[model samples]
Target: MSDPHIISAAVQEQRAAIVSQRDFENLYKQYAPFLLRVCQALCHDENLAADMMQEVFCSIWDRRTTISVKGSWENYLYRCAKYQYYNHQRSLSRFRTVQDSVFAASDESDDSTQEHIEYRELTHNVNQLVEQLPDQCRKVYQMSRGEGLNTAEISKELSLSEKTVKNHLTKALGFLRRNIEALFAFIFLIS
Candidate 1:
């Protein structure tokens, strides 16, 4: 004879395996915000983060019938968010490489050469200005802009409050802005 407990366990397993629309809604409600925060922390752009988070949830819904969760949903969703953010970044890098090649091939005239030289000079000047910033300010600026880290990550990594990180970044940018204005004016007069 069939064991009653075994049959009941099998029934519960079958029910738990299929996520209903209501179950999906509940998961979205509970984790969407958290997922969005994860995306933002990775990329620091609100709209892009939102889009990536939405894509993760949409993909989940599309594959809901075949998906099996063996662990906690939070970890699963967090991995999904990270995967989406990295995927988007990879795509952007590829697109930029292609775009740069196209632009490079299309512009080879004297004006293009002059523009390239100007761009190089401007970049060099910016680097010099960045290097001139105070030590902590430079580190904060580089982490926030060069490494694309958000203020919170910079705060944690540097063991400073978020407000202090912001202050450093602000001072660094302000100093750069003031100096770059002078550089631009000098360039404008020359051009």
Candidate 2:
């Protein structure tokens, strides 16, 4: 009584509607190698391509509930592969940036250690010269240079006249210059 073509068509529609678990499994198995090949062609790296293929399949599985396969399944899988490839490329770029920063910081630390050693040596030599100054002159010099005080502030703190403070700083500078010149001359002679 019923047309066979119509009945067959109805059964086919029912089968599409159900979308059996076995069909999805077979789809994954069939397309996996193809997807991996597509990924490899895009990335040119086997391990990265494999990772992208897995990510693409995981994304598809997550959205499988609402999937309406309009065109060939091959086209859809290829599009997914393309997106995954781009995403992986972006991840690679970010990883490179992090690696570069880590290397740059290590290099900076090496340079900083050299600079710190030079600074310590210079400060130690200056401290030794400062220690050789007269007691009151040394205190005034420390307040002016170490504590960053002006002559007026140093005079107020030490209960000395501003003229006296100025004289102390001038004497301290003359002492440091003479000491540094003599030390450099001695080093040159030794060398």
Candidate 3:
């Protein structure tokens, strides 16, 4: 091989005309083997390495018409290859990171499903407790809490006075609080 600095200097001085077809062919012959080896080291596939090497040569050929070099051609080729490899690895890492994040989100969805099941069980228990209330109290409680109605709205719906609605709510709340306290104590003892 000729001196890399002299080759680069010649290419730079002559520009398009100096980088003739023969010169391009020689450069490909001289550098393709080493460039492919570099690509293989980075990509770990012979076919991919060959493809990347071909791309590198094509890029260099396209830029040969205008590209100027101030240093050794060998160094420039290696640097370009190294940058391409780094960019490839960086993109691969980003894809892996996104995949990992999606996997983690899937796990969270599983946790959310378990939480929803537990919530449904709790709602069922509370619904059973509500059913045990006096019919009028249950109706008033449902009307007040479920529909987000005011005492006046509940009063109107049940044909009861506001004071009667308040009395039903108070009794229902007292019964629920006492029952819940006793249930908690029983659970603690059982556990």
Candidate 4:
């Protein structure tokens, strides 16, 4: 069996090295997969879980100078991941609440009737512009804006590279901006 003193010395050396980028990279390489699994189990969405895992690592790296892991590093990392997941959930909940309130207020406003009509017209025109986009660009723009999918998710669903998806979205936006300058200018004046 290995000597307990030797094992203790190795752990002490590792703990002392945690402030260095190389040590942090080693820690990330060793623990990122396990942390991602934990995040996936908690968040229940692959994209959100990946984001949470990244956030956990970012927090760890930011706090490296002051972090004090008393016991198992695995436990400490898991706790950080859990906290990040909870924070993400809370932020999403708050955003939804604010969105709901805004919609509710808008619905209750009779003065907004004309504004709503104008908004719908603008939306129809925008849809027409989107439909006029090249086939691949139209598909990417629709999936991103109408379906609310992120670039990575859109890339996976459509079997395209993420960079390609981004390029398509950029092209679509540029097309819209050029075609809808008048409508956007009106919007800019109002809001």
Who wins the TM-score comparison? 4
Candidate 4 has what TM-score?
0.54
lDDT of 4 by residue, 134-180 (tens): 99999999999999999999999999999789768766775675567
Q: Which stretches of model 4 miss by more than 4 angstroms?
A: 1-17, 110-191
Higher-scoring candidate on lDDT, 1 or 2: 1
Please say which candidate is ahead in TM-score: 1 or 4.
4
Task: Please estimate how well model 1 matches the true structure, expressed as its whole-model Cα lDDT.
Answer: 0.78
**Poorly placed runs, candidate 3 (over 4 Å):** 1-11, 14-22, 42-44, 110-191
Off by more than 4 A, model 2: 1-20, 111-191
Screening candidate 1 with a backbone cut-off below 3 angstroms (N, C-alpha, C), the clashing residue pairs are: none
CA lDDT, candidate 3, residue 67: 68
Model 2 pairs whose backbones collide: none
Question: Candidate 3, residues 131-158: lDDT per residue as tens digits?
Answer: 9999999998888788899899999988
Report the number of clashing residue pairs per model.
0, 0, 0, 0
Overall lDDT per candidate, in order of appearance: 0.78, 0.75, 0.72, 0.78
Please state the error at residue 41 of candidate 3 in Å: 3.6
List per-candidate RMSD values in Å.
14.2, 29.4, 29.1, 10.0
TM-score of each: 0.49, 0.46, 0.43, 0.54
